[model samples]
Target chain A: MSLKMRLGLVFSGALFLVAVAAWIYQLKEGLILTNMQNSYSWGLYISGLAFFVGNAAGGLVLTSSIYLFGVKKLKPLAKLGALTAFANVTAAMLIVLPDIGKPIRLYNMLLHPNWMSPLVWDVIVLNLYAAAAAIYLYILMLPELTGRLGWLAIRVDDPHAFSERWAKRIAPVALLFAIGIHVVTAWIFSTQGARDWWFSPVMAPDFVSVAIAVGTTVVLLAAALAYGTGEKYQEAYRALGLIIFMATCVHLFLMANDLVIHSWYGNAETHRIMDIAWGDFGPAHLFEVAAPLLGAWLLMRPQILGSLPRLLASSALLIAGVFVHRFLIMPAAYNNIPMTMTPFGLPESHWSLPIASGRFLPGMGTFLDQYAYFPSLVEVAILIGIMAYAVFLVLLAIARLPILARENQ
Target chain B: MKMGMVIDLEKCIGCRSCMVACKQHNAQPPQTWWNRVFTPGSHRHLTPPALGVEFFLPVHCQHCENAPCEKVCPVGATYHAEDGAVLIDYERCIGCRYCMSACPYGVRQFNWEDPEKAHARSEYQEKYHYGYPEDHRHEGRLVYSPLRPKGIVEKCTFCAQYRDKGELPACVRGCPGKARFVGDLDDPDSDVSRLIKSRNAFTLLPEKGTKPTVFYLPPKAKEV
Candidate 1:
């Protein structure tokens, strides 16, 4: 194996070990280790799940868009997108397993499902999307694998012809599933009418547009980094960057629309959520909003967008922006429980009482009093492990599998 | 028949007896209260001068007819019983805490640690017990299960197990001010039903459309 691959394996392996340690600790101590409390029950784990699922959906959407548009130049990068999608979706599913309190009873979700629950819908659609993405990836690689590998060549007479026909048939269905997965995730939040922040009808569309932007940017950066900004791939990178810029603009527009509607005409509950987002969470919120706009500007500049280093930096910033966006949505809504009087009533005094009297514990507090949420050490470790695992899978695929399409083909 | 409660805010002195009774009976872990008393209004303190007409509001699960928490449970761990009481099946809970988030009243509490461990370390052990399978027994069954495991969401059941034995909920019976009343809401002649009719009772967060069974009679207007 190459030195880069060896180093990646070591790093991811360490992360995997750390994650296991964290999980064991969590199981022994229960969720008390985490900062989450009765007030903010769905914290970093749920937010991270949403972000990772978006990443996965974004990858599939980008690949499907390539086929739909008949972009011949981008065809070489399709395999990379498909592989990323499969790896990311798998990682997303794994990340959520640890968050479940009773993982042994998790099968009950499928066994005795509640059809009305958006969570069940999320499970059904995510599993279906993962399956479709895997098949799509396999179809993409079948011809190359059969032709190159000695064993496969002997068994298959015309793998190339069969793959082409099958891929053509499955592409549209895979695309549908990709869109469905994100919509289901968005619905999980939006369906909660009790939360004014998530009840907006624009949530699903916003999720889709942001996914496209982040997904396309990640693919662009990965391709540019792996295969230099040479003449062959430069056009493909530029096209992908343009798509990212467009999608980012749409995402920003949706955000602005939601903000204006909520802040201007919305009820007191909605305004309170806006206050938290623009007040205590101001720094993260500002970065989330500004980074994407700046990245779009960079992408618009021909010289900057063409340079591999600059494009990678811009994409990295854009991805961070999207992550912050996902993180802010849930907490802002949670901090806005209408009946909780702390945030609006007496600010400093009541906040200190719960903490001083030891009634609140370390992380526990009225939702109205505090909005600060620091992910516990266990949560951070688990998240790092999950990301590292995703990186490990992608690296292994790139090294062992026929991921890159041939130049002549 | 639908069972419900009517809390007289006018009579409540914020003594926290109901909270104590609930903890003792349910064997809840430290810092977990199925019932909580809040001094509503803009008053910084609970003093008589600071409080004008507003009184202490003790909040618990409303057990709504259109319960948001029941609708959002992915595993059907939380459900509405035939008797109109919102119930949780702990064995089926995946501990996703979706019901906690869905609850507008913030009545739901998740066991962050083992209830037994919490009880053992608690300073108030003399007042409340917290092992699995409570000391009290009914028909040879433990009044409260001892195995109150961590990582599951819990809330006030309105003492359904006690109600089954033709006894009042611990909170209602323990109230010194007789501020809390429980009866069959479906029965027109029930004391709770009569109280709601005569006293202009109100439910919390009517805009939420939860249709809460827990009614509240606002404190009587203070004389000048």
Candidate 2:
């Protein structure tokens, strides 16, 4: 293994252990360890779920599209893309274990599943996405694996031809599942009319766009770093960059379209809610917009695309940007109850719900009109652990498997 | 029977008796209120809004006929009881808090920690673990317990335990001003129905279209 990969594994392994410890402590103490109260019930953990799901969806979708469309340029990176997707979807599922109040009682979600809840659909899609990505990845690696472990294999005259044929059939299924996973995730928020921000038609399609942008970013970054960004892979890099940029622009347009309507609603309650994203949360929202655009711009620049370090940084920025977008989903939705919408003639000051903050603050007031949530130290620790583990897995897979041998050195 | 509540905003003195009584009988944990009295548009509970008159708007589970909480609970933990009340089965809940988010009224509260830890803070509570000291089950669902299990959702069951015994809810009985009433909302001749009809009754956030069973009589230039 490379020094960077070894260092990453060690670092992530250490953090993942710490995350396990923190999660155990959290389970022992119940959700009291979390900053989430009844007021802001869903927090950083849910954001992580959304962000990682988008990453997972984006990766596999890119891989499958290569087969479906027969995009020769992206063919080489298909294995790595599938690997990334498999790892992320797994991480996405694991992270949700900590977010729930009774992690042990998760079986209840399966045994007594309510078909009406979008969350149940999310549970199914996420699991299905993980399983399919794994199978899809094995197919991508079949030729290489058969060569290395010849004794165990039924020899195909052309292993490459056989695997490619299988990959073609799985491509459409994987692509549709990727889209399904994202739509289900978005519906987990959107189906509920209680949250004004989430109850929109655009959330699902917008999530798909975001998945495409961030997913391709991961593939681009991984391909550039793993195989080395050389003249041989120039066309692939260009195509991937265009995909990321176009998808990101589409995401931004939809977001802006939603924001414009909110701005024009011409009501005090809406203006106040809009002020949350436009005012107090402006810096975070600003970063959400600027990072992806800058990163996409860097990749689009052919000179910067060749610079491996620049490619890595752009990918990091784009990933960070979408993560922020996932997080921004909660604030406007959770910070205020939509019930505060006053009658047509009532004055503008229909206040935010004064909700009980579950944990005792010693001397501080327990009730808040509008609570600003920051993840507790334990929550942050667990989040870091999950992300690091996903990174470690992706790196380990690429290095260990002879998977990328067909591509450039 | 479509059981529901009708609270007259004018008659409530902001005494918090109903809030206190509900807490006592229902055994809510620290900082968890199934029934909360608020002065609407005020920064603090019971504080007057810009309207200058300090009237109370006590809120709880509306027990909507088209309940969002019931629909959103992934485990079918939250359900509409036979009496038209939205209820949670503590044993069945996965504590996902989806129902908490789905409720527009914001009445749902999760057990952040053990109920005993909540009781430890107050000397009075430490000595006396109040509420009806029994597990009340309806049709095999553990709807009410003296202390709910940690890591699950709980909310107003409209005093299901007391109602089963043919008694008024703790909140309704404890209202010193007699401002609260409960009856079969489905029955046209019921007291709650007549009160709702006569008093310009409204449910909170009618625009939400949850079709709340609980009604509120908006104060119409009345001095209590």
What are the C-alpha RMSDs, in order, of all predicted structures? 3.7, 2.1
TM-score against truth, every candidate: 0.91, 0.96
Clashes of 1: 4
Any idea what lDDT model 2 has? 0.83
lDDT of 2 by residue, A105-197 (tens): 888876989999989988898888888898888877777775555654446888889888888888878877888888999998988888878
Docking model 2 quality class:
medium
TM-score of chain A of 2: 0.95
lDDT of 1 by residue, A231-264 (tens): 7777777788778889889999998898888889
lDDT of each residue in B1-224, candidate 1, tens digit only? 99889999889888889988887777666777778776654334364423244457788889999998998899887877777888887777888888877887878888777766665655555545442244443333332454565777778888866776788998999899999999889999999999999999988878889999999987766554
Lowest summed lDDT over 10 consecutive residues: which window, candidate 2 chain B? B118-127
Q: Looking at model 1 chain A, which ten-residue stretch has the lowest summed lDDT?
A: A349-358
Q: What ranges in model 1 sit over 4 Å off?
A: A147-157, A340-368, A406-409, B42-45, B48-51, B120-144
TM-score of chain B of each: 0.88, 0.93
Clashing pairs in 1: B132-B146, B132-B147, B133-B145, B133-B146
